[model samples]
Target chain A: MNLAAHLVMLPVLLPLVAAALMLPLGERRRPLKVMLNLASTLALVAVAVALAMRAGTGAVDVYRLGDWPAPFAIVLVADRLAALMLLATSVLAFCSLLFSLARWHRVGVHFHPLFQFLLMGLNGAFLTGDLFNLFVFFEVLLVASYGLALHGSGSRRVQAGMHYIAVNLAASLLFLLGVSLIYGVAGTLNMADLALRIPAIAPADRPLLEAGAALLGTAFLTKAAAWPLGFWLEDTYAAASAPVAALFAIMSKLGVYAIARVWLLLFGVAAGPSAGLGADWLLAAGIATLVFGMLGVLAAQEMARLAANSVLVSSGLLIAMIAVGNAEVIGAAFYYLVVSTFALGAFFLLVELADRGRSAAADILAVTREAFGEDEDEADDGEVGVAIPATMALLGLAFLACALLLAGLPPLAGFIGKFMLLDALFAALTPAAGLAPAVAWLLLALLLLSSFATLIAMSRAGLNRFWAPLEPRVPRVRIIEMVPVALLLAACAVLTVAAGPALDYAGAAARALIAPQDYVEGVLPPPATPEVAP
Target chain B: MELVLTIAIGVLTGSGIWLLLRPRTFQVIIGLSLLSYAVNLFIFAMGRLAVDVAPVLEDGTGNSDPLPQALVLTAIVIGFATTALFLVVLLANRGFSGTDHVDGREPPP
Candidate 1:
């Protein structure tokens, strides 16, 4: 009845309604659709901010659709982690919308509506408290993504989009299989109810439930782009139009978020026999993904492919730390998730602007020269003073910021995030734990090595694009395009400045996740009054 | 009856996965469709197979579980949409690349 009660559903409903409203308008009404889309996204941001503030106060707000009771009817829960994810998504969506307005919005039909639909799906995915509902939302977002990926259609985009679509379709089937198995065994799809039921499940049924969870996890990890399953990500993200790719930076994280939410809630210590289920597989998979991503980053020549590979590194790091199952480390992982997501989105946007100056053959030539060990024909003129245009300077600074953030270089939010994670990893070590300490050390080494690899790859890309050209031809970047990149980088700067509060929020969110009681109780409250059938 | 359904699912899934790995786009699409059919049946069985029973629990006489039916319906609709979308994308890929191979090019003979 009150505004607080309604706040939980607004994020999901706002975009759906906005998208529906935009669908009826004709192509001639592009400006109107854009205006509607922008206004809706801004309002979603406002709602997300309010939700986060409310959740920061440590109150779990649950909105039951049609006022149905929990465990039977659908409910949307807004706890700290959900609110944090919603806030991050809304801000990223707003920026991507702004970036697309410059030219991408006109490149194809129904771009604005599809964007809104994607937002709706993403918000719904984050907010839903039901597993089947989660599957529905995954389908929702994936369908919208399929459209967006193929937008501004080109030969390469179509080729990549086909693989992306086929792979995801298979993943979706796996998702359905997993959900049905869990439902068949647990007899419930509501996450809170499953937490209550899993501990009491028969020992014979336990394996089925775990199998279901593994299948579900596989579906999510495929989206997260882990190791062998992640091969599609590089080509797909590389070939996608810039703004769509930027928006997709969060989509990969969506998989990690789902795992964190569902895995922790259902299989936490509260589940007795089922406690710590699948943690080992997660760790092994995460390590493999990190190593593979490191190799991918080192091998990449194109800026977009490089950024996509770096996304794999971030995802692998998060998934591995999450498997470590320490609240402190999980908290640090959340911090890293936020920072890396923002950095990756900015880098994807910047790739378009920074890449426009050079001919398409530049990157390939650089690679070939490296392979052949060719010396530069031009003599090095140290300290050649060339007047740089203001636009080029701004673009270069943003690119530098992205590079620093992705590579975890010092004096930026990325460095702070890695430091916090490493610190938490060290703090979590114990004598009685046999293999954890070894895993901690391995992860520590991988983190630093991946950062170094990203630095090398990014520097090679930066030199080729910005520094390699003797007479730098500045790309014609519009104000609309530049502002979004600046806004994202500025967010990273702000994150760096306010590290204490950000880390504190992440800690609280992680603690809530590690202890599922709060979420379970929040979703399934004691019956206030017995329902009277009319 | 359960064994028959299980075997059917297993066979469908096996064939689907095989076709999914093939080089041709059309075969891949058929593979996906077969896979979805298998999944739809699998989900349906998750509700526990019942014959000639009302899905709704009116008088509670041999009522089948209704939830998986609903879930399967949603999955079916989504599977249909994605198949159509994949078809369109495959056609577009063919239009651009001038090949039916999933990789967008033919292998040398």
Candidate 2:
């Protein structure tokens, strides 16, 4: 009934409506396409701001569709964590949209429409209250991504896109299988209903539930680019356009978010042996992913490929933190998600700036000159252009933020997040817990090492481009591209400046996730009978 | 009986993985499809292999687990769509790259 409640639905609906409207607008009408894209993204930002403001008041806003009671009907719920993620996503979406504006004409048919649809799916995924609906939203997003990933029809993009699509589709099937198993055991589709129903199920049925949970987790983990299942991410991210690549970076995190949400809600309270096994399994998998991803990032050569690999490492660390299930780690994970999203988003934009021209000779010369300052004659004769000085300045700042953030350096959001997660991991360590301590220590070491590796790789790439010599002439920095990079850089600055409130909010969000009885009660009324017929 | 079926599905999954690792795009597709069939059956079996009982509430007696059934239905539809999408991508890849290799590239000189 309140304005905040009304704002909850707009993030998803605005994009859905925009996508529909853009379908009728011919692709050749470039101005109209740009207008629609900007308008919709701006509207999402407004809605995200409102949601954040409302969340600050200390209560989640739940909207049930068709005004039906929670268990029987669909619901859209927004807690502080959901609100914060939506805000981060909107920031990335806005920047990517601005970056794509100038190139809209060149991107060919349905680019704008697919973009809008992708946002619709993202917003829906963040907002949906039912497990089944999450799958639908994921499908919606992936279908759109398939188009965006292969937009240019180049062999590399097409090949990478096929692998991406294949792996994702398999994961989706696994996800559905998991859901069916859960439904069979719990008899409810609504998350709120399932939360209450799940804990009450018999012990004999618990293994099925655990298996279902693991299957579901596997599906999401694959999407999150967790190790062993994430072979497709590096190639896919490397091949896509910068704007699309930036969007893809945020999209992959959706899976991590889902896993965190589901685990805390369902298994966080499961008693006895089940809890021990569930927690241990998650911790093991999370640590393995962290180590594998970090090794990959350290070994990567291509700039785009390195950034892509870094995403896996960061997500893996977050998952490991989530496995600890301490409130502090949850808070840290939330903050880390925001910082990583912005940093990676900016990195993709920077990669676009460097690779704008198609000539290999120009690229090599530009890199050479940028790495070492030289007079025009001394610069590579093949060098055709250079990055604008102002753009280079922004790129420099972007790289610095990325290094500090991803490396978990002091005074940045990433540092604070990592510190909190490590503190939680330390507290969780015990002699009785046996392997957990070893795992925790390994995770901590791998996280630190990975962050350092990301720092070095990015610095090398950044140094080669921004700090090196002047080519005879530099490629002009396009205004459209600069807008996204500037906005993301601004976001990182805000994160650094407002670390206290952000961490506090994240901590509160984490607590809310750990004990979601309120969410359950808010969505579903107390059962009519203490026990329902099985 | 159910255990045997589960083992059979596991074998199917194993074979699918082997094929998926092969270099050809067509083999990869076939591998994925095989894996999907195995996975779907495995998922359905997790509901504990109910027979002669529908999940729908009936005659005030017993109903099989409704949740897994609902989940499997959606999974089936989504799986079908994904398979179709993969097939289309395969066709497009062959057309664009003039090869059906999974990597769509010639081995290095």
Candidate 3:
């Protein structure tokens, strides 16, 4: 097999194998564990790069499990969108791993294994071509995430973890229900097959199909933290460790990705005018989530909570953009997802630095009290926390990147994405399509208001933390902590510079996704009569 | 029979949601469990009601859909894992905070 074929599977298999390998290694061998993680991520990056190259050349790489034809057996597919997401996934995973190197000792046993398994699950979900496979991968990732979320075993972590697990498990049940109905009616688990078959089902059965679709959408929307279903996110993200929190950011987006894929493929034709809550419902929910998230951000007291709320706002924007359904808007959604993930990942890393800084300062204060025996006043006098000026500056830079990304400031990738989406919405507003015009205007207004709210919230955080003077002394920032934050921030800078190519590629990917007949044909040869579920 | 069962599931869901809104952690867990049961049954119903038919395919005979059965198996396992994880987390929170409240911190003075 060519390298592209290997690329399709390596992202998932490498991590699965690495996780198994790590399990046998002694817990004391931290260096070996780190090496395995780094190696696996590097391998994934290489595969992602190779896949991107192939996709750029306009080739869709499909891997048939057990060498069986489509609709008969499982398949893994890597298209332009999958490759782009794979690249983003690997980039975030690499940066998070780098951040965890120093913090792993704090996290203790099985962190390496669990992290690798989580990556395995994430990659599997992205690559799988079958709906059932997607469910399996989701479960795999959720299991690992449960352990990682509760890693520290603290009271707050536990409380948040319970909510997280409860919500996700409920979503999983809905997912199973939806898939079962889809399969019973459509008689296929293969996504490509379903796409081809679902449209041909009898009009009378369409309502039943819509119910299944709605159930699936509900589950995915809950996972994506959409309005009215996202109550668990703020507290859960706030309580998670910084590195683990960064991983969770991407996890939420996976649901959005799944929703986009299923809607554009299986339901787009069947969804027509008769389907009650198609893209419009998503757009409405997205706007509501955006407004709610911004409010949460403004209400937040802590830096971590603020960042968490910002994630919801960005996710809402992405979902709304996707709902527009125009090729250009979908392209913009892809670009926005990439930018948001990068910015949020960097923000989480900065949170870790700030946390360590506070912890170290506390330790220093304890030592000072011990040294000045019986003189509590002396120990407290003029001795403030140690603040590392350089670390603060780096964190400030990261904050700037995050602010620009979230607020849609110019010269950043977020600005370009939002501009493209708004342009598409404006173009869609034609007098002939009266409803479209009103919806387009509403979406644009919502986007603008959300951006303004984010700007205010972020500025408040920046002013309170960076502009204000710290206590007399603050702990020095460690190099180990600074490296990952700097690397992720640099990635954001590079993404900003490469916005043109990124948007262009996203446009092509979106076009391909929206019109998936090519993908369906590529997966399965046309049948004499396309099977339609009754 | 199916209508009655569906209504029962709906009642369970309503009760679960009510309990979920409570402030206590243990109550929330119980609520989640009740909700899960309701959800599982609801999912099973989506396959369409079958009294005597097995999900397995037989020669030239109608059988209930097997796909939902496979999905339910996966859901059951995942649900169990999540429930176990939740219980562990609840115990850990009780150990640390000396209270079984969902919000660990005391309200601002």
Candidate 4:
């Protein structure tokens, strides 16, 4: 009943209420709606930070709705992992909303409300202790994203939006089927309770449970943008407006977060036969996704598509590391997740600005030149003497920072994260439940190869866009739009400077995730004595 | 009852997936609807089929499980909303692309 207990619900409630309030205000009061949206997001950040600090002290905060007791009632648990994800979500939401203030919010009807609802769903998914609740939250977020994806309503946007909707609707059905299957087998939908019951489940029902879990994993992987399941990602993201794409960069991570949480908590070392049920398959899928994403990055001509591919690369790395099932490696993966997501968001915003400086024919011309083996320097010889404007220079620097981050280059958080991740992967070389030495070496090489590929592709695109422009036109960059990019990049810089503490926090979260006894106990307390009516 | 339910789910899913792969937006939307219906029925059957029994417990011996019913209700509501949204988007897509093909263009004759 105290304030800290209620804080667990605020992240979900604040957005829901704000979105409801904004819906009734109508389109005429755009400025007021923007202010309300900004205020709500900023407040969410504050709450998330506070929860992170509280969770850092190694406490699990649980809030039961309507004063209902544990397993039967829906509960929200804010442990280190949930709090960390909430913090990341709020930071990205705040930045994306700020960027939208430039122009995107006015692009279509109900933009502000949809944005808030998306946040609500994301926070709910991160915090919910019940599997069924997770499905509902997934639906909420997907619906909002469907709206936001088609906000500008160009032909390309509408086409991509239709595909996105169809794919996700199917995924939602799979989610329901999986949840029901698990419920039928385990007779409970609460995750913590299921974790307790899974170990003692009848052997005859094991296959059914595993099948259900596989279905569930498929649903999450689709949303997470795993290879073959995520062909819709690039088109949908590339076609979306800048702010929406920036916001979506975090949405992909939501799947990884769920996988790490559920897989580690429910199928960990405690489950006798199911301890490592699908680990190898997860590892295989992750590697394939990583390779697919590398090719995508190299082949992409548009800047937005390049950013989208980088998201896939990051997701692949995280998914593979999570499959390693070592607490330490998972910790480093969390660091990588946070840094890469921020960088991707900033990069998406930067893409719009960078592409704005070029003429409409620039992309086609570049392709034609490449196809014909024409010298690009000779084509722009007439405009060679034009000086780069200050705005262009700033964008170039931010672009350079993003390139470094995406490719895992040094002197930024990306390098530190990748280094820590590699170090942890090598350090965790136990024969059982850890990476083999050869596999570790292979992962190292693969990581390096992917990073190298990203570097090459990014430099190629950078040169084609920034240096080989047919004309040096300065985009009318708004201060509001520019600051969000700056802020997100600054966050990456801060992460680099504070790598020691950040990794420690991530390590704690990973440990808490691997051994969720506190989480389970926190949610399902010893039955409280019933009050006698006097 | 169980056999009938299982066959229905199987047929619906098979047809839904087939329609899902069709070329037109309208077919895809209908496919999605059929898939959702199959999933809803599957979830409802998870509680185990019972005949003429109260969902809520009166004496608790012959009562059907209430939780799956509740879950199915929520799923149906969400599925309805999404199907409506998909139809709207389908119309908009047709209007914008001037074609009903999922790819926004017709195939060669």
TM-score of chain A of each: 0.93, 0.90, 0.91, 0.93
Clashes of each: 0, 16, 6, 0
Proportion of true inter-chain contacts also present in candidate 2? 0.70
Ten residues in a row with the worst lDDT in model 2 chain A? A378-387
Calculate DockQ per candidate and list them.
Answer: 0.95, 0.51, 0.54, 0.91
- On residues A1-534, what C-alpha lDDT tens digit does candidate 3 reach at each position? 576556688888999999999999886686898899899988888888888888877677888888787777789988888888888888888888877765433444588889999999988998899887898899899889988887655556677887788788778767876776777676788888877677576778777777778888888899899989998899888777778888788988898899888788776644454332477788887888888898988898777898889889988888887777778888888988988898888887776565444553244234423432425334533333333456667777777877888788887877877788888778768664333777788888988888888889888877767767354223355566566777776777787888888888989989888788667776776762254334
Tens digit of per-residue lDDT, candidate 2, span A240-313 = 87788998888878988998888787777543345534676667677777787777777776677877887888
In order of DockQ, best first, we have 1, 4, 3, 2
lDDT by residue (B12-104, candidate 1, tens digit) is 999999999999999999999999999999999999999999998777577999999999999999999999999999998898889999999
lDDT of 2 by residue, B76-101 (tens): 78777777888989998898688887
Candidate 1 per-residue lDDT, tens place, A175-221, comes to: 99999999999898999888888888889998999999999999999
Off by over 4 Å in 2: A1-4, A270-273, A357-389, A422-439, A469-473, A527-534, B1-22, B34-73, B106-109
Looking at candidate 2 chain B, the ten consecutive residues that score lowest on lDDT are B65-74
Considering DockQ, which of the candidate structures 1 and 2 is the better prediction for this target? 1
Which residue pairs in model 3 clash with each other?
Answer: A385-A473, A385-A474, A386-A473, A386-A474, A386-A475, A387-A474
Q: Estimate each model's TM-score.
A: 0.94, 0.87, 0.88, 0.94
A1-534: candidate 4 lDDT, tens digit per residue: 477679989999999999999999988898899989999999999999999999999999998998788878999999998998999999988998988776556657899999999999999999999999999999999999999998866677788999899989988888888899999988889888888888888899999999998899899889998888899999999988889999999999999999998888889888778887899888887888999999999999888899999999999989988988889899999999999999999999999888866664245334334433445346543332333348877888999999999999999999999998878877876576447787777778889999999999999988877777666677767677788899999999999999999999999999988888888889887452122101
lDDT of each: 0.88, 0.77, 0.78, 0.88
In Å, residue B85's CA in model 4 sits off its true spot by 0.5
DockQ of 3: 0.54
Window of ten residues with lowest summed lDDT in model 1 chain A: A376-385
